[model samples]
Target: MAQPTYALIRFQEVGAAKVQTGLLVGDRVLALGEDINTLIRHWDTTEGQLDALAASVDGLTGLAVSDVEVLAPVEPVQVLQAGANYRKHVIDLAAAHRGPGEDEAEVRAKTAAMMDARAGEGTPYFFIGLPTAIASATDDLVLPAYSNSHDWELELAAVIGKEAFRVSPEEALEHVFGYTMVNDITTREYVFRKDMPEIGTDWYRAKNAPGFLPTGPLLLPAKFFGNPQDVQVTLKLNGKAMQDESTHDMIFGVAKLVSEASQIIPLRPGDLVLTGSPAGNGAHWGRLLKDGDVMEGTITGLGTQLIHCKDEEPTESGQQ
Candidate 1:
């Protein structure tokens, strides 16, 4: 039998600006709170009421899931993303981009060994993402005409419940309230600056474009999806499977990412710590995003996200 799945959402009537918090149960979404942001701030006290109602959805009062328009689940104060957190993903990139005479087998072996060492004592690499980059799961992505090398990185993000500062990995999971999905879009051309190599990655230009991070239609409570480390992470382009991997491939797990990130800065309610994307990104397949291309991303237990892409239209200034 399938486990009962429930989520929290923010939705509104189609084409209306009004939005409200909703409890997404079986086939319907119950009107649950005045504001989901404020509700999640006290998740420890709120989960009991939500879990009880989710245990049984019979005779629940609300609109059907299809009747209302789902919005980005939460208005996060901060969005944090980890880079190169997948073991195989790092090895694959290394092997694929090896220097002229380097053997593929040798490159893979070196990368694998480096990853093992990092797991033992290395710190995770995290960068701040703008909340402005977020979009609804079903929203259209405006493909910037500046570069045609747009790519997708489908990842699982942990939502912060309790405030955390200098927490250990062992105690990190307790602070996670739930999970959601984020598709971290990138522009390959701006990933590494050619003009100033010392500065390293230009994340703001490579990412942070409006609608670059298409987020959740659901926020699955952590208790409901125990062991997020073993879940499947898959994404398909158009109708073909482009990225199919599991969370087991991660070099650093969610808890470590959260803990390490907290050490850098305090984590608060509604803040998101994105566990990095696994292998099989667009770079692996040699096919980048384009106009009219559709991306479908899924994480086990969490719902699928469908995003559409279109080229950005030129304005009178002739800029995109």
Candidate 2:
């Protein structure tokens, strides 16, 4: 079988003759070119056409990915992310609870018990992240100064293809434009703050730091990555494979995710529902990020994203 292909939007310079990536795809970005700013201003209705344009831009002039800065694909009218979806990560964590030096027999018994608890799992767990928190490919992520439990989650994000509401799961893919790799990095302490256990009121602050959500590499059309369940997703921290799993473990896949969200809340074009991250998150092991740590992650067919954490500094343009 041939590998899946996607339309990658990127930045481009005005006088440059070679094709280039744009600063933003669904949203306006000045560095990407005037076309992006115009698109961002009208993203509400132009998203479908934009995906088509991006996918169809073959044999073009004045744009090469090398020439421009790459940004997140969608400015995102809204964002939804899932929690505890990977089966292996869930299983591994449960095994660890048996305590050190426990007999192998105890490990197997505890694993079975954990699986039973997941039976009849309800609606997919989801929380919103700020659109302003989104960053582009190659952008630097700022570690929160106030918190120390910062972490990373690698997952697949689905982009809405067209306007949709109350659609059946079987017909849901029709509303999908494509897919992208997303890093749903979080501050664990902030996310599960002792003060607020409820997700709705507290999650935004926990997950919405300036560069909490780093996405892109470009949009992989849904037709290319058929059966979202079968795709393989893996992540490595500083050259070690920490997260390796498949979307097959998702308790709720993309089709259902779209259908459920739309039944009550209207899902518009360019809205993003980041399918939940699989287990192996640093937090589960107390392996929080330290300064200068480099992490790389990827989803099959969606491409890869690399993130590095370092000490903060003032920008030349006066950004702190």
Candidate 1 on 111-210: residue-level lDDT in tens? 9999999999899998889999999999999998889999999999999988889999999999988999999999989899999999999999999999
What does the lDDT come to for candidate 1?
Answer: 0.89
In model 2, state the lDDT of residue 3: 30
Best candidate, lDDT-wise? 1
TM-score: model 1 vs. ground truth: 0.96
* TM-score of each prediction: 0.96, 0.78
Question: How many backbone clashes does every candidate have?
Answer: 0, 14
The TM-score of predicted model 2 comes to 0.78
Span of 10 residues, lowest total lDDT, candidate 2: 23-32
Give the alpha carbon lDDT tens digit for every residue of 191-292 in model 2: 555665553346766788888888887766676668888888888888898888889887677888877777777777677888888878896767988788
